[model samples]
Target: MPELVGTDEDDYLTLNYNGFVPLLTKAMQEQQTEIENQQKEIDELKAQLEMIMKMMQSDMSDKTDNKKAENNQKPVKLSMATVK
Candidate 1:
């Protein structure tokens, strides 16, 4: 449906809608590649976050165990009052 509508010498080299298919295809392919690369980076970051969470959990458990041991070593004192 694209018709050539040029008359001047400067309008001899004109691109129609069909001529733009290759350019659009190339642009879409490049964008897809960029999207795939970004997804790989996101996956790597998620793995790193998982490792950090595991390390924090292990450290927290150690601290909790040490606190329990300290509390067990202390003696408890009780107070009593006499009533008539």
Candidate 2:
């Protein structure tokens, strides 16, 4: 609430432009400060998320390489003898 500088009820009710302007200006400044802080926080979170995604992709690639290596190994075979 803004302070009423005017002494009379009629002066206060008529709207004091001088007092109202400063109050509105202060409010706008406060809101801008809050918005800037929130934006900085959001940027930090996005950076962290990107790093996590890259790490996950690398892990998945490693798993796929291991599976391919296992599949490429040669299998062992046994010899059979004929009975008379």
Candidate 3:
């Protein structure tokens, strides 16, 4: 197995320093990229949820309006065959 060297400032000038800096930098950049990707995914999910909520609200409003219209209409007696 490879050993961890030049991990501290005390070993900063070791031959491994050149290798360690680039590797650490790459890791940081990868982590940053992952964070950005996750943020975008979260934003998309939030937008989708908002759209669903709006659709549900619109459906509820439509149902309420239909009920109001029915209430305003005069009732009529219907035969059992017409009920379906």
Candidate 4:
């Protein structure tokens, strides 16, 4: 089995600075960036959902107001005509 420890000269440079493997550190940074991008997408989707919900609520209120207007209107009466 290959040794778990990476002892290449490039690894040595970073290992001396912060004890992190260069390859692994770069991969970690990339993953962090991806997470940040996904978080932004999630925030945008949440905003859209909120806007949709508000539109639905507004539609419901408008329908209710229309119904109330219909109910409050005066009823019409028709007069029967007599044939001569």
Candidate 5:
């Protein structure tokens, strides 16, 4: 149960090196683990974003193809004399 005390000069002052070294080392290790976990989460999010973008592009392409098909169809007209 060692407590870290901050000095007025924005520095740390510790009297017990034997206890402080282990505590500091543990804190550093914990911080490293947290950074690694956050990086993994960021990578996963980037992958998900890429997948979503691909799906959106595919959907847009399908819609464009459907519109082209509709536009390529010819219109039919009936004459009044033919009907008679």
Candidate 6:
């Protein structure tokens, strides 16, 4: 139980442990908000990274296809000689 510890005679002011609750509650709520915002930012960055990876994979595949097509155009020559 919170008990009033003292009072100012001139101003008629009283202080107690119960007064701390509102401040503590506000601080806790702010911390929760901060944690949520950070989580949201982290998720967005992950999504962006995934997109970049997909684009790189697509570009690599196209380059591989081009290389295969070029290789197909080249001809192979083999020469053999017999001496007696």
lDDT of 3 by residue, 18-48 (tens): 6677788989999999999999999999999
Which tens-of-lDDT digit does each residue in 15-60 have in candidate 4?
Answer: 2444447767998999999999999999999999999999999999
TM-scores for the candidates: 0.70, 0.72, 0.66, 0.64, 0.68, 0.71
- Using TM-score, give the best candidate's number: 2
User: Residue by residue across 6-80, what tens digits does model 1's lDDT show?
Assistant: 345766655476767887899999999999999999999999999999999999999999999999999977656
Model 1 segments more than 4 A misplaced:
1-15, 77-84
User: Predictions ranked by lDDT, top down?
Assistant: 6, 5, 3, 1, 2, 4
- Tell me the whole-model lDDT of each prediction, alpha carbons only: 0.84, 0.83, 0.84, 0.80, 0.85, 0.87
Could you give me the TM-score of model 3 versus the true structure?
0.66
Error of model 5, residue 64, in angstroms: 0.8
Candidate 6 has its poorest 10 consecutive residues by lDDT at 75-84
C-alpha RMSD by candidate, in order: 5.4, 5.4, 8.0, 8.6, 7.4, 6.0
Task: Give me the displacement of residue 45 in model 1, in angstroms.
Answer: 0.5
Candidate 2 has an lDDT of 0.83
Off by over 4 Å in 5: 2-14, 74-84
Clashing pairs in 1: none
Worst 10 residues of 5 by lDDT: 1-10
Sort by TM-score, best first. Answer: 2, 6, 1, 5, 3, 4
Cα displacement (Å) at residue 15, model 3? 8.7
Q: Candidate 6's residue-wise lDDT over 11-74, tens digit each?
A: 7657887878987899999999999999999999999999999999999999999999999988
Error of 3 at 80 (Å): 29
